[model samples]
Target chain A: MILEGLARLGRSGLGTLERLGRAHLLLAGMVLGIGAVLRRPGLLIAQLFNIGVLSMLIIGVSGLFVGMVLGLQGYYVLAQFGAAESLGVMVAASLVRELGPVVTALLVAGRAGSALTAEIGLMKATEQLSGLEMMAVDPVRRILTPRFFGGVLAMPLLAAMFSAVGVLGGYFVGVGLLGVDSGSFWSQMQSKVDFHEDIVNGVIKSVVFGVVVTWIALFQGHDSVPTSEGVSRATTRSVVHAALAVLGLDFVLTALMFGE
Target chain B: MMGMGKQRGIEILVGLFMAVGFVALFFLAMQVSNLSAAVNSDGYQLTARFSNVGSLKARSPVSMAGVRVGRVEAVSFDKDTYEAVVTMRIDAATDTIPDDTFANIFTAGLLGEQYVALEPGGSMEYLRDGDEIAHTQSALILEQMIGQFLFSKAGGD
Candidate 1:
């Protein structure tokens, strides 16, 4: 019984290692395929519309709600210390440094990343990828690469919009509703949040997330078995795995960027 | 449903999305953060040495007469003198501060962050890059004040 269990553990460990190696290879291939996709910009533009423009409504709505919640909660907490005037600083700082990129990435993983996986997986199930291969067209270059570039290019923009809307949301709640002085709300935020340190770092985080989330989605879809059940499973796995990867990478990035 | 006109519309929508994204980033960099702050523009460096800095850090405001004139660029320890050497970047426009100006650390509000406040002197020569302020006062520590008070009371008794 002990020997059997040990064998099973070793097999699973090797299986995970194999998956990691395959994912790295896919990443390398995608990097090379970028030139191909760039040669035909229209493909990338179409994917951008599907990935970025479609995701905007959800990102903006969530950002506004999240910011409003932060303002409400921060007011109560800081009011106890008689520092409620720092509401703008608190809201902008938290949104820019932590919530903006991370939340946008999670939402994108759920919204766009899964859709990419499903579409690609369905194409695989229908042998469309093989059909392209038979015609001497590389699916990774013609299809996956464009989608990958779209996600990477779209992520930072979505994160930026989320943060800007979030700050406005906080302003509406803190100044308009909570009676905090309007001048202090904006001035304090301008003084406290450094552009290079906070906003640039947030953009960097979003770009990294875009690369990671889209890569996982593509790899999972490509690796899935060519069946309906397999496509569904790949879609589910892509979301779960991308989310976990994002959260884990976020902790490491935050520690590196913000830790003293 | 996927016609040439629809294709053109999609491309236009994508272009609009990218434009909006750039605007959002501009808003974040320009309005939300301190990108347009005077500290980022051309400046001259000045050094001040304090016996104790006490929570003063890089990027803290360096103000003259309650108006921000520069920012603390770096803080380092001078092992030979056991003092904290602070580097400040004074804005080029505020170049009239005299060489003998006194630099004192002050807290903005109760339990708020500390900043370097400058008191101008009557000296004709102005401070330039690499100039060191002659007079300096360190951050006040509450514990030191209480200790001095107790010692004075014991001496009176």
Candidate 2:
């Protein structure tokens, strides 16, 4: 009798996992499709403003320090070979490919993603979402779409800022302080990096990361139980999930892009 | 209600500050990209003959007297001559390089990028465009340099 019960529970657990996977795919498809149709000048402008402008201070400050560190580390290794001029190429490539998108997404996930969860969780606890439904308003379109689009739009601009600042920091250390020739620095960068593909790829990754992070936050928040403790739990879960999603997606994208 | 309104106002102000900060950062990136592009056009050309191109890429600067005058524009092998000919573009404003200027392929640092350095000669005439720099030195490959240094030290010991 115990063995039968255990088998039943195992079957049910597998069934639940399958259903959860299907539901996630359905949600992703719906959000992406709706986002495509709803793309508009006003909506985009609002999203850009929320994501890019409002989050710039944090992103810029962090990026500046990251750039400085990359320069310092790259110099330590490269100076052994007397190849310091290549610092520009190293700095530019690292910023554009790995650091820019990943760092910006992580930052946004921590700051905006957490705030989004808290706000939505509070609304759920207060039954505000139910009130919207009673008033004949589409909560998905009205509430979730704006925040989702806002994050998606903000990510690319922030990543670009990070890349640029990182390069500048590298230049300050590699050229200005170390006395490496400026001409050599710029030449190495231009020759090695393809601006079109590398820059565009980074931007695209940021957009996808933004969507994933915002959706996870909103999903967790909207489903929270109607209690103070539930709201707090939801907020914490949203941040943890969003951060993990960003990291996992980054690895997947990198493999797809750079993997031979 | 007044206190709530004040809190909301503060939030809006913080948001506005973030937006302005992003705009400034974007402009900064644009400026740097422009600066790098402009600096690339200011150098002169010198042809270097090399047995192995290795990591030596085009747009690689050619330096002389510790100043960059041109960039490596193209690299091709002459089938009949059996020599690797690298064409470079020198800055117009710079003084003409003497015909006997020796070209040597050297690296920026130990593991850094490779560039061709020209040592100017005291000859009267200048090298015209398309003129092959006759006195050329090949790149001192890292392995060879290290091996030679080690072998000499070991022989002394």
The candidate that achieves the highest lDDT relative to the unseen native structure: 1
* lDDT (CA) per prediction: 0.93, 0.75
TM-score of candidate 2 versus the correct structure, residues matched by position: 0.66
Give one digit per residue, the lDDT tens place, for model 2 in A1-260.
99999999999999878756754863565366565437543444455555566677888788888888888899888789777777887888888788999998888888788787888888878888889989996666666667777677677777877888778888888788877789878766765665444665677788788778888877777767779999889888888888888899999998888774
In model 1 chain A, the worst 10-residue window by lDDT is: A182-191
Q: Model 1, which residues run further than 4 Å from truth?
A: B38-40
Which residue runs does candidate 2 get wrong by more than 4 Å? Answer: A1-54, A64-97, A121-137, A162-201, A222-231, A252-260, B1-35, B38-49, B70-103, B109-111, B118-136, B145-157
Interface RMSD of each: 0.5, 5.3
Question: Ten consecutive residues with minimal summed lDDT in candidate 2 chain B?
Answer: B27-36
| Tens digits of lDDT, candidate 1, B1-157 | 6798999999999999999999999998888888888436689999999999989999899999898988998999999999999999999989899988999999989789999999999999999889999899999987898899999999999
lDDT of 2: 0.75
- Model 1: CAPRI class: high
Instruction: Give the per-residue lDDT digits (tens) of candidate 2, residues B105-143.
Output: 888767667888999898989987667788888887888
